[model samples]
Target: MTILQPQVGHETLELLTNVLIGNGFSIGISSQFNYSSLVELCDLNIIDKKLFEELETSNFEFVMKTLVNADKLDKIYNRTDSTFLHAYGRIKRSLIEAIGKIHPEKYEIDLSDNYVLNKTMVRHSKRIFSTNYDMLLYWMILEDKKHVDFFGRSHNKDGTLRFTPNRESEKQVFHLHGALHLYLNDGYIEKLNTSDHLANHSSIVELIKEMIELGRMPLFISEGNGEEKKKSILNNEYLNFCYKSLEDLEGSITVFGHSLDNEVDSHIIHALNNAKKLSRVNYCIYTEGKSEPVIQLEMSRITYLFSGKEVVFYDSESIRNNMRVIEFYV
Candidate 1:
C-alpha cells in the first residue's frame, strides 16, 4: 500500500512504533518483569508491605500509577510525607537495574537485520516517533551512516547531548517514552551520548553498565491507565513535546506496529483524532493468520474515533515481509 499526503509537497510520512514493532529483537516487555528486587532495593517491607505486593506482580508503570494515587490521597489529607515520595526513587533505580539485566547486549544483536530495517524506514518515513525503550530502533537508525546525528550532537550545560531532531538529516527517530540509554534528572530528559564513542559491542556494554552505576533509569510512562499515562507524559518536558507534536500531525499518518489498544492507549487514539488536517490514517494491524475478536474491536474503535476521515488497514506481516520498505506515493 502506497501512502500519499493530501498536500502536494509533503513527501516522507509520519511513522510511529511501539514495543511490538516486529517479532522483535529486543526483549520487548512481554516477558514477565520481576519487581521483587525493586521492593528489596527500596526496603518497602517496613514502609508499606501492601504497596510492595501490588507492585511485585506488576511493572514499574503500574507501580507508578499506584504511587500517583497515593500522592493524591496524601494531598486530600493535607499531609506531605517525604518518605512515600522517596520510595519511588529507590524503586526507580531497581527498575532500571532490571531493564539493564533484561535487555539484549549489543553483541547479541543481528546487525544485518538492523541494516535492512534501517533501509526500510528511510524509504518510508523521515520523522519516526517510537515508544520503545530498547536500542533496536536506535541501532537501526545508526545503520544509516550519514544520519547518526538523529539524537543531535550539541551538548547542553549538564554535560549531556541535546536531543534536537535534525529534520534536514531525515530519518529522525524520537523516543516518546524514553530509552534504556536515556535518564531523567531535575525534570530534564538526557541521552547517553553513545553515538560517538560506540566503536564496538564491548564499549556499548561498558557504557550501559557505567550509566546504571550512576543511578539513571529510562524516562518512561509508569502508569497503568491512559489518563495516568497522559498525566505523566504531560509532566515531562520531552514527552509533552512529542505528544503535542503528534496531536498536531496533518495529512497522511501511518501508525505502524502499534496495537492502538483502547484500554491503555486511549491517549494515542485521542492524539490522532486531534490532528485536524488528518486526511487519511494508514493503521497497521498485526495479524498472525486470521483476525481475532480483540483485533476486530480495536479496528472498530479506531474507525469510530475518526468517523469523518478515511482509514486504511494493512496487514503488519505484509509490511514485515516487504523488509520494512513501505511504498509511499507523494
Candidate 2:
C-alpha cells in the first residue's frame, strides 16, 4: 500500500524536459503563444548551460510570511500584468502541455500504473493531496476517467475531508489552499468555466495593474512568519483531514516536489512522524543529486524530531534515466 505523492515543480520539469526533447518536440515552438520564456528556460537547461544559484538565504518562513501578507503580493502584482499567481499557474499549465505534447502515452501509462493499478492490487485506496493551485492534476486524472474521493461531504470550514480515489462517489479532494481555477464569489468557492482561458484579454493584467496603482496585494510568498496558520491554512477542515490521513494505515508515502517549508504544514510532518511509530513509514524524497543538500537539510530537521521510523533518500539521477513510476509497484 505505498502512497506516492510527486511534487510538480522545477525538479519535475527538469526530468520532463529531457523526456520531451528526447521525443522530438520543437525546441522553440512558434505556434505556442508566450512560449519564449518557456523555450528559453527549457533550452538553457537542456543544453547543459550553467544556471545561476538561487538566493540560498531564502527559507520557508520567509516565503510563508509573504503568502500570509497578501498585501505584499498585491503590490508586486499591481505593477506587472503578470501576478505571481498568474505566473505560477502559467508554469503549471506549460509543464503539463509540454509533457502531454511529447510523450502523452508514456505520461498516461505512468500515472495509471503508479496510482490506480497499485491501489487496486494492494487493496488500499489511493488518495492525492496537493497544494498546487493549478488544474494540471485534474486534467491528467480526468483523462484517465478517475475522480478523487474527498473525505467528507461537509462544506463547513471545521469539517474534515478524507478521500479514497476508489470511493470517489463518496468523497473528493479537499483543496486546503485556494485553487487557481476556483474563484471566490459571495464567500463561496466556485469553479471557473473551462472556456475562460483569458487568452491575451489582459483583464487580469489590467486589473492587477490598477491594483498596483492603488497599492494592492501580491499573490505569492516572498518572505515572513506563516502566522495565518490558525484561521486560514490550519483551519478546522485542514487539521482534521490531516489527522484522519495520518491515522490511515497506508504503507510508505512518497513525497515528491513539496518543500515542506511551511510552518503551518508542520502538522503534516507531525502526522508522518506519528504514522512511522505505528508502522514502517519510508520516505522517497526525489531531487536532482545537485539539489540534495536542501532536501537533506529538511530531512535532517524532520528526522531529528521523528526517529521512530526509517527515512530513505532516493536521488533522481539514480532513477531518472531508467525510471518509470510504475516500476515501484511491480
Candidate 3:
C-alpha cells in the first residue's frame, strides 16, 4: 500500500472539516503529545525526583495495583508506610489540580476565537468520546451548551443525582476514562455541578483533595496495562457506558490526538471492528516533522486495524491551522 501524504491543502482540509460537521460521525480524543503540559505539571508536582526514579525502576502496573488493591494482596506486601497509597493520592491530586487550573474561565478570552471551532465541529457529531480526565471537552460543551448534551449522569426532582443514559440528544459527549468532576456517591457515579463550588468556597482541586484525605479516591482510571485498563472500564458503570456507546456507534469515527498504543487501545480497535454500521475510519496523525518511514509505519498500523474499511488519514497540524482560521471567522 502506498503511504498517504498529509492533508495540507485547503480543499482536502475543507472536505474533512465538512465530514466532521456532518451528523452520524463520532470522535475519539486521547491524551497524546498535546497533553505534555499536563504531564509536565504532574511530573513536577506529583512525582519527586527520587520517587520518579523509584517508579521508573518498578513495574507501573504492579505499583498501581498495589496502591489501589493492597487489601487483596498478601499481608507481607502491605508495609506500614503505605508508600504506594500515598503516591497514588499525590498523583490523583496533581491530576485534579492540573485540570482545575485550566478551568473554562481561564480561557474565556481565547474561547471566542479558539472554542468556536470546537463548538461548531462537535455540534453535529453523534457522540464525542474522550480517554482523558481533563475538562477541555467539558469546557467546550459549556461553550456550546445549547447544542451539546453529555451522557452518564443527571439530577432528579428530589435533588439527587442519578446515572441514567440519555440518547435523545443529537450531540452527546462520553468520558470513557472518567472525568475530574465525577465522583462516586451512594454507590453510583454522580457529576459535581460547577455551581456547587461557590457555596463552600471550595475549588475542584479542594474537593478532590478532601476526597483523598477522607480515603475516597477520585474515579479516574490511569491503569498502566491495556488489559488492566479494559478491566477497570468494565468494572465501572460510567466507563462501561462510554465503552458500549463507542461499540454501538454507527457510521464513521474520527480519532484525534490518540497514539492508539496497541496495548492500551485494543478495546478501541475491537469496537471499530465490531461496530455494526461503521464503514470508514479516519485517523489524524500528528507527525511533528518525523521522517516518512516513521509516518508510514504509524499509518500501516491503523490500516491493519481497519483492514476492510475505507481508511482515511489527516494531518493534525493541517486540522489545527484550519481550525485557527475558522476560529477567527466564527
- In the order shown, what is each candidate's alpha-carbon RMSD? 7.5, 13.0, 6.6
Candidate 2 weakest lDDT stretch, 10 residues? 18-27
Predicted structure 2, TM vs. truth = 0.43
lDDT of 3 by residue, 1-330 (tens): 442344434443433321222111112222221333343555444354355456542222234445667534534765566655666667656655655554333233344543455555554345677776655565567667743334333455644345677646655777777766676766767665556544674455456556545554456664445665777789888888878887877767777667677886777677668887878877777677698899999999989888978888877556655665554554
Candidate 1 whole-model C-alpha lDDT, 0 to 1 = 0.56
Worst 10 residues of 1 by lDDT: 3-12
For candidate 2, what is the lDDT?
A: 0.36
Estimated TM-score for each candidate: 0.68, 0.43, 0.69
lDDT of each: 0.56, 0.36, 0.58
Best by TM-score: 3
| Candidate 3 least-lDDT 10 residues | 18-27
lDDT of 2 by residue, 277-329 (tens): 33443344444443656766766864665467655444333333223443343
**lDDT tens per residue, model 1, 1-330:** 322222222222333321123223232222322232333444344555476565543345456557667778888899877565566666655555555665566555555564454446544555566665666666656555544333444655545665564435544455666566666655556666665556553656456655555554456553356665677788767777777777766666766656566766777777778778767777767556555776777777778877778987765444544543342332
Candidate 3 residue runs with Cα over 4 Å from true position: 1-120, 147-160, 202-207, 214-216, 325-330
